[model samples]
Structure formats: structure tokens, C-alpha cells
Target: MAVHVAAIDFGTTYSGYAFSVSAPETDLKDVEILSNQIWNSGTAEVASLKTPTCLLLSKDRKISAFGYEAEEQYADIVLDGDTEDYYFFHRFKMNLHNNKNITMTMVLEDVRGQPLPAIDVFSLSIKALKDHLKSTVEIKNIKLDDRKTKWVLTVPAIWTDTAKQFMRKSAEKAGIPRDRLTIALEPESASIYCQTFPSAGCRDIVEIESRYMVVDLGGGTIDVTVHEKIPNGTLKEVTKASGMVVAGLRLMMHLSNFSFAYLADHF
Candidate 1:
């Protein structure tokens, strides 16, 4: 029997998935790279990549939307409300860890002035991604029954144990099995891909006896790590790493506000 493995990069602003097929004679040479592209626009000049997150609502007071479409639709509706009973937001991953002044509201009400919990919002997003995986691939429906499909989910290294537990719970609420899920640090995963580059001639080798910092400036956070290279070419952690979630996109938003204010005065 062949095995299907799925890897999910569950990012803050964007998320993605890659799958592999296990078969006989499936060595590194036999592995095929799958194209992740989903949409194209413009005069055959613009191509948009797909991300595994969305906002959606069903007719029966349920939300629905996923991937790039969900993201675009969420933005469109948030800025220009045309749809009723559907409220969505992208880049919600950052808000998951934030506890200060964060508020979320749903359209449906049950006589109480309360909206859905944050975990519910996250579950809806996960469901959209799960639906996409089912529709895009040719896996047997029995696979769903067998519950053999496993997932590797990525998270920022700076996340606390509490945050990590919440993410696990959210995934469970989205129908992903607890035993099938494995969590990996985002920067560490990126480093794995980065380490392959020196062998590919993409970057020159740097030989240093002392420890060095690996600073990852991502869309939602800034991660810093200090690693020591051993004599056998293996990397070891010399000190504890740190990160700040209030970087990257937040900084850009601040700059944009300044630019808009200056432009308004000039115009």
C-alpha cells in the first residue's frame, strides 16, 4: 500500500501545503515536484499563488471561504461591505496570540450580544483549507474513513506553550485528528531549506568558529536565533532564541499611515 504524506505551513498572514506520495522505488531521484500555483491573471503576465486560509459562511449561519479567493473576498468585504451575514478577516494569525484590545464579532445572534469565540473563527479557516485539499487531490474517500492522513503543521518558535496548546485545540475542532498532527518551528523549517542552498551553489560557504545569529524577518514576527557550527558541520544551539510578534507587517502599516497623512496634506 502506498502512503500519502501532507505538510502544512500554517503561517500568520498566509499558509500553504505540500504533499508527497510514497511508492515503491520512490527514492529522491523518483520524487516529483508538484506545482503549487492555482490562479493566473493579467495579460498572461500576472500569477497569484495559493495560500491555505480563508473566510466563509454557509446559508445556515455558518461561515465559508478558503485560500486566495477567501482572502480577496474578505478584504473586499471588510473594506467595502456588499455581502450580508458574512464577516471575514485575513492575517488573523497575528491576532491569535494578542490579548490586548482584540475584539471579534459574528453576524448571527441568539438574543445575546456575543459573537463566536476566536477558536471558532480559526476552525472555520482550517475547514476551508481541509476542503481545498480534498477537492484538489485524488485521494480515496476511504482515506478519510481510515484517518491515516497525517499533517505536519508549522508555528513560530517564539510562541508560548499556551499559544501552542490553543493552536492544537483549534486544529482538533477543525476535524484534524490529534495523533495525526505534528508541530514544527517555522524558522527551523526554513533553515532546513536554507541549508540546502550551499550545496546548490546558491550561497557561498561561511566558516566561523563563533556563534552566529539567524534572524528571520517574516510577515508576522521577527525571530532571532544563535547557532554554533560544530566541526562536523552540524549546527548546535549556543543560546536561547527570542522573537517579537509586533514587527514586519505592523511596521509597514505604520509607515503607510505616515505616507497617507503626508499625501493628504500635499493634495
Candidate 2:
């Protein structure tokens, strides 16, 4: 019997899944990336690589929308409405490192009193993603009944122990089994993929030493790692990496501030 392995890259801005299939030779090969594996569909065969990290709360105090639909609706509400019931926050992953000190509140007219915890909001999104994955993939027969499908989730290298623990807890609450879960540094995972390309080769003939700084500029954070390349083509970490949660999205928000002010004054 062939063994089936599933690898899930649960990113902040995007998430992806790749499966490993064992052949008759007992060798495993990674299959192509799966698409539309995370949400319901109403359109053509277009694939969704990344779902927005935003969630929409309905007047009934439930998760009314998610992913791109939530993103669109939230944008419309923020840009063109006077109603304050709807709550939306993009780049939610950046907020993970804020620890438990900061409390995010929502004062919806429908729901009385204080707002929901940031962690709860995050948990809801994580749960939605997990549910989506379970429905799309068939894993019952491949694995033993007692053993659940395993997943490898990627996180930033600079994530504190507390933050990582929080993420793991969130995953548990989202229905991901603790026994089957593994966490890999996001930059390391990206490096593994990048090293596969031939263009990343060095030029020296006899002895060559190369160092690369992998800068990951994502929607929520910017992480950079320095890797030392050895003769055998394997990279070793030399220096500690550094990252900032503030990124491109912050710049866009700054620009939007001015644009929104101008529009308000003119219109």
C-alpha cells in the first residue's frame, strides 16, 4: 500500500496544500498544488491561492462571511458607509505578536457591550480554513482509522515561543490534531523551495562559499534570513534572522489615509 502525505502551508495572506503520493517503487513524489481547496465556489474554474485574512460578522453575531467575499464586503462597508456595526481588520497575522495585553473590541449594535477577543476572531478564521480543507481532501481510507492526516504548518522564524504556542492552540481549537501537526520556519520552507531552482547556483569551480539573505515580503510581515551555502549545496543558518510585522500593507494604509481624507473633503 502506498503512503499518502499531506503538507499544508498555512500562510498569513495565503494558504496552500501539496500532497505526496507514493508510487509502486515506494518512492514519494509531491503532486501539484491544490486549488479552490479552501472555500465554496460560485464562479468558473478559477483557483484561489490566498484568502484574505479578514472575517465578517453578521448582525446576528455570527460569522457571516469569509475569504474574498468578506474582504469585498468589508471594504465596501469601510469606504462607503456610516454604519459602525461591521468590523474588519486586514493583515491579522501581524497582530499575533502583540501578546495578550492588547484587547480588540467590537461594539456592534446587534451585539450588546464589549467586543470579541482578537484570539477568538483569529480562531474563527482558522476553524473556517480547517473545515474547508477537510471537506476538499479525502484522507479516511489512505491513513489508518486511528491515525489522522498529518500537516506541516509554516510560521515566521522570529515568532516568539508564546506566539507559536498560541498558534498551535488555535490550530487545536480549529480541529487540527495535535499529534499530527508539525511547525516549520516559514523562511526555511521557502528556502527549501528556492534551492531547487537551478538559477540559484554559484560560479566558482573548486571551492565556493556563498551566502544569501532571504527576504520574505508578505502581506503582513517582512522576514529576512541569512543562509550560508556549503559545497554540497546545503544551506546552514549563520546569523539570527530579524523581521518586522509592518510591511507593504502598512504603506498602502498610509496612502489610503490621505486619499480617504481628500475624498471626504471633496465629496
Candidate 3:
């Protein structure tokens, strides 16, 4: 039996973790899910529930920083003319989706176009988040026993089995035991999260036989899924998850290009 349930949302643009203590006596509705503290981008006044999916590695192929701090340090490194000795990566999650020939030894290109093993990049990034979560829980006087904790990792539903396996391998390399880790679909996770709110004001809307559609507008793609609540208090997918490649990041790029064109014409 698990004593804690922790979930890591490893998103394309941002990432974060949340957890709840497992108690058989407590009703599911009463379980409190606590998320990590807000992350601030050191370069600006920006803050969010999740940090940027960025990472920096030293010349020796060791992780140097992650999230917003990674961005800040990479910028400083460039300004100092030491960029050749460092690697900066951001928005690399989509590589898994776009590449159909993913392999255990495939390499990922950094911001500088330098290549590094994909496993190293992913495993290090996950390790950073996992370590932070453990520290956060420890601060609350909770000792996380590896045997009693179940870890959940969310990925896009459209991902191929090869990609999912890659993630699992990366998680294992990051120190999460294979038996204790579970992979969850992003749309499904979102649907369940929505059920936690009160029905009168957005919670408890998902009752037995209730059916709904979940559209996830993520940084990498837009995914749609239909789910029905079963008598077993679990959700069943009515249709296969379908998604388009165009989503948040694509929209932003289009808007940025349009803005640039307009400025160039005016100036």
C-alpha cells in the first residue's frame, strides 16, 4: 500500500509537481493536493506555478542548473564569452514527439546546436525536479520512504510507445524505481483534476455515468479526449486521444513573427 501519491507534469514549456498523502479513512474529496511554490524567472518579474522547461549543463557533462535559474545563468555565460563550455536546452520535449526513430542512445541538440545524449538530458532534468520535490516534502517533516511512495509522470497522449518507453528509462535513470513509477496521460490527468472541484462551483461534476470532453492546449500540441465516469469511480476513455501539432507554442511563434513584420514595415 502506498502512503503518498506524487505526480510530475513534465510539460514541453513548463514543469511542476504536486502530491497528496494517502489515507484510506479520508474521503477522496477531502484529500489535499499540495503543489510546489511558485517559480520566478530571474530575468523578469514573471512567476508561474511551473518553471520553464530549461536546463544548463557544464562542460564536463554535468547538470549545472534548471528552470528559470538555468536561463539566467546561460545568459550570463554567453555574455561572459564562455558559451562554448556550456549547454543550454529549452523546449526539447517535442523532440520525442517529432522523432519517430527515437533510440536509447539518441542525442539531443542544445541551444548552441551542440549534441548530447538524450538520456542524459532527460534524466538530469527529471532528477532535478525529483530532488526538489523530496526536499520540499522533507521540509514539512515528512520522510519519503521509497517503498511506500507511488510516482506518477504525465506525458502527452499522442506520444508513441517508443517515446513513452524512453521516458520510463529516463525516470529509472533518475532514480525512480520501475515498480513504483506510473505513466499517466496528460488529458486524463487534467480530467481527473477537474473533478476535484465542487459541482455547484465547478467541483464534483464528474459523477457516475457522466461524460465529458477534455481538450488540452499544451505548449507542443492540442489534444482532445472524451471520457465517461464509470461505476468504479474511474474514468474510461470513450474515444482515442486525438491532437494536432499546432498549439500554444506555434501560436506564440506566429504572433511573434507577425509583430516583427509589422514593426519592420512601420519603421
Question: Which candidate's TM-score is highest?
Answer: 3
Clashes of 3: 3
lDDT score at residue 35, model 2, on the 0-100 scale: 41
Candidate 1, residues 141-215, lDDT tens digits: the string is 324322687666677888776667767777888888899887777766665555444455424323444455678
Please state the error at residue 158 of candidate 2 in Å.
Answer: 1.8
User: Local distance difference test, per candidate?
Assistant: 0.59, 0.59, 0.84
Q: Once superposed on the true structure, which residue ranges of model 1 sit more than 4 Å away at CA?
A: 24-35, 39-46, 52-54, 58-61, 71-83, 100-114, 139-146, 195-213, 228-235, 246-248, 251-267
Output the worst ten-in-a-row residue range by lDDT, candidate 1. Answer: 105-114
| Candidate scoring better on lDDT of 1 and 3 | 3
Error at 181, model 3, angstroms: 0.1
Estimate the TM-score for candidate 3. Answer: 0.88
State the lDDT of candidate 2 residue by residue for 56-91, as single tens digits.
776544676667777566556556753256655445
lDDT over C-alpha atoms for residue 78 of model 3: 65
lDDT of 3 by residue, 18-77 (tens): 988867777777888899878888679898999988888998988899999998887677
| Model 2 misplaced stretches (Cα beyond 4 Å) | 1-17, 21-48, 59-61, 73-87, 98-114, 138-147, 196-210, 229-235, 251-267
On the 0 to 100 scale, the lDDT of residue 191 in model 1 is 56
